[model samples]
Target: MTDTLLNEICALETALQQSQVRNDRIRLDGLLHESFEEIGRSGRHYCKATVLQDLSHALKAWHSAASRRMRRESAAAHSPQD
Candidate 1:
């Protein structure tokens, strides 16, 4: 179960990265939802605290990336050089 959870986390990270590359908001949201669901299901038979912690960390990473992207776009829009 731990291995499964780890694999799921890795898959979610990959999907997130791919979505980021394509700027696919819908796909990214879906992937995030699926990741949460998987974490919840896996928590039933695994270390609940650890699984939740991992999920939280994943969410934070995603949010951080999103925030950075938004900041970059905003900066570009306001740049006088552009």
Candidate 2:
């Protein structure tokens, strides 16, 4: 690919990664094609819908875990020292 095309592709990839990390569903929806499909390394098939669903679930789990950690730390910080 030409340098300009290569740069554009790289930029799109970086944008995709950032969107996923930030859980920006709107951005993802815009970036991914409706018929997008991926065959994972394990040979599992995933479509656009499946990928988005997985990301949503993962984001929920991550937030839950982070909240729990924050609560534990807060409790420990407030508790009297031994």
Candidate 3:
């Protein structure tokens, strides 16, 4: 691909990542094509609609896990020596 096309693709990829991180569903809808499809590692298939629907649930679980991990680390950091 030419440099200009490559740059555009890179920028779109960056936007998609940012949207996923931020859970920006509207932006994701705009970025993703209606015909998008994915074959996940588990051999399950997902399409654009399913992915958008699942994103909220996935992000919530991720946030909750991260929060718990941080709390554990913080408690460890603040624990008194034996």
Q: lDDT tens string, model 1, 24-73?
A: 54454454443344334445542434444655677789899999999999
lDDT tens readout by residue for model 2, 1-82? 8999999989887887784543876678777889988899999998889888987898899899999999999999999999
Q: On residues 1-82, what C-alpha lDDT tens digit does candidate 3 reach at each position?
A: 8999999999998886674543877788888899999898999998999988898788789899999999999999999979
By TM-score: ranked, best first: 2, 3, 1
Which runs of model 2 end up more than 4 angstroms from their true locations? 1-10, 17-22
Give the Cα error of residue 31 in candidate 2, in Å. 0.5
Instruction: Give the Å error, residue 49, model 3.
Output: 0.3
Error of 2 at 60 (Å): 0.2
Top lDDT hit: 3
Candidate 2: count the clashes: 0
The CA lDDT of each predicted structure is 0.62, 0.85, 0.85
